[model samples]
Target: MQVNLHDAKTNLSRYVEQALDGDEVVIARAGKPLVKLVPVDSTPRRRQLGFMRNQGIATADVKGDFIDDINAMFS
Candidate 1:
């Protein structure tokens, strides 16, 4: 579905919902295609926080016993 610049601006939310529903949306300027609207990847990536552990690299536990000392310094 193609829409002119003015109509795209006026009904931006409706077009966004259409795009999210897997519709191909195109914005045009002077009858020329300008841009497309698509949904972003919503999957959260898992991080390897302690990748270097057990490999001789020492790591600190930020939420461990040292948390009390850290709070005391701030107070």
Candidate 2:
């Protein structure tokens, strides 16, 4: 839905709710489109317990060579 800047400002909360409900909101200035407000996909990420429990221990073998490791990735 297209709305003027003034109307968008006045009913900002309502427009936000509409966008969150999967409706597209277009804010216009002088009949020209300026921006669009759309809903972001907010699907919850799965919870994984202890995914990095031993990662730090594995890195202990490295002796202050973080910069070399990073540069090797680029090369």
Candidate 3:
């Protein structure tokens, strides 16, 4: 279904519900199709912390002057 920009803005939630129900939504501007609203991937992307934990990222690897430089710049 297609909706003009103004009406789409007013009933955005309703249109989003429709899209979530597997209906294709096309937003238009001056009768020209602009964008499509579709359902997003419900699956959450997997993530882990400490990307550099094993990449020689210990405190000994950090520059000794790094903290002093940062403090000097911020203070």
Candidate 4:
């Protein structure tokens, strides 16, 4: 729903509640749409921090041995 800037400002709280309920809210200026209010999904990803410490990264898992090759080329 599109609303003028002044009206949007006056009913800001209601618009925000509408947005939270997954409704699209468009704020317009001089009849031109300028911004949209949408709900943001704030869900955290599952991760295990101890997994990294318990199973440390292996050196062989690395790609490209540029340091040794570069030194050999210079020598």
Full-model lDDT for every candidate: 0.94, 0.90, 0.92, 0.88
1-75 per-residue lDDT for model 1 (tens digits):
999999999999999999999999999999999999999989999998988888895577777959999999999
TM-score of each: 0.64, 0.55, 0.58, 0.61
Error of 4 at 41 (Å): 1.4
Candidate of highest TM-score: 1
The residue-by-residue lDDT of candidate 3 on 1-75, one tens digit each, is 999999999999999999999999999999999999999999998897887688884467345748888788889
Residue 56 error for model 2, in Å? 13
Clashes of each: 0, 0, 0, 0
In model 1, the worst 10-residue window by lDDT is: 57-66
Candidate 1 structure, TM-score to reference: 0.64
**For residues 3-73, what per-residue lDDT tens digits would candidate 4 score against the true structure?**
99999999999999999998999999999999999888798888877765757756772236577777777
The global Cα lDDT (0 to 1) of model 4 is 0.88
Top lDDT hit? 1
Candidate 1: regions farther than 4 A off:
58-75
Q: lDDT by residue for model 2 over 1-75, one digit each (tens)? A: 999999999999999999998898999999999999987777999999999887775545454657788778899
Clashes of 2: 0
Q: Considering lDDT, which of the candidate structures 1 and 3 is the better prediction for this target?
A: 1
Higher-ranked by TM-score: 1 or 4? 1
